[model samples]
Target: MEESDIVKDIEKKTRLTSLKKYMWGPNILNLTLIIMVSQQQFLGRLSLLSTVLLLISIALNGITLIFFSKEIRYEENQQGIHKPFNKLTIRLLIFIIIFFGAITIGYFIR
Candidate 1:
């Protein structure tokens, strides 16, 4: 194939890879978090409402991952997962990292 054709092929493959990650990547992380939380004992007492909220959040995360996989798979014929990352996604990811980092620091400090 010509140089232009090769470039196009690479672009196509990269897009496919991105879509695959988008579809399946979150589930892996989500499952890992679930496992860690389930295994590790939480120190101190938590209120019933807090526990319920936590369970709800976990369920929502699982559901979201499932829907994400379905949507990504459904777009198999498309060029790629073309979903635009808006403010909410960006903030959510940032907050997730920051929140986890804070928790880790607190764990160590205690």
Candidate 2:
């Protein structure tokens, strides 16, 4: 089989351009928490470690998304699977919200 055929097969089977599928999980989780934080009731109910994971996930995902967005923007002027600036801005906003929320909860819990 040709190299291009192999790549096409992989892309078709995975339904994501390898990079995207890998990054999607964490980004989606971060977005989930971003939504969670907006709901007042879920704030203190989750365990501290869980909260920590959520915070870290948001941070890492935000950073990853930023890089991903920048790369996408540089690659093509037209839109592809994702919009670079929108994804970056949303992830960043989510990270900020989660950071402040986590700090506020930590103080109250302590």
Report the Cα lDDT for candidate 2: 0.61
Name the weakest run of 10 consecutive residues (lDDT summed) in model 2. 75-84
Candidate 1: residue pairs that collide: none
- Give me the candidate number with maximum TM-score: 2
Off by over 4 Å in 1: 1-15, 23-25, 32-42, 77-110
Q: What would the C-alpha RMSD of candidate 1 be, to one decimal place?
A: 11.2
The true-versus-predicted C-alpha distance at residue 19 of model 1, in Å, is 3.2
What TM-score goes with each of the models? 0.41, 0.48
lDDT of 1 by residue, 1-110 (tens): 55697787687677657766774565555655444434334544445465445445655675665565554554544544455544335545754674455345434433
Model 1, CA-based lDDT: 0.53
**Per-residue accuracy of model 2 over 1-110 as CA lDDT, tens digit each:** 45696776565445435546566776677767755544435454666676667667667777777776666554433324445456657756766777687557554654
The model with the greatest lDDT is 2
**What Cα-based lDDT does every candidate model obtain?**
0.53, 0.61
Worst 10 residues of 1 by lDDT: 37-46
Cα lDDT for residue 6, candidate 1: 75
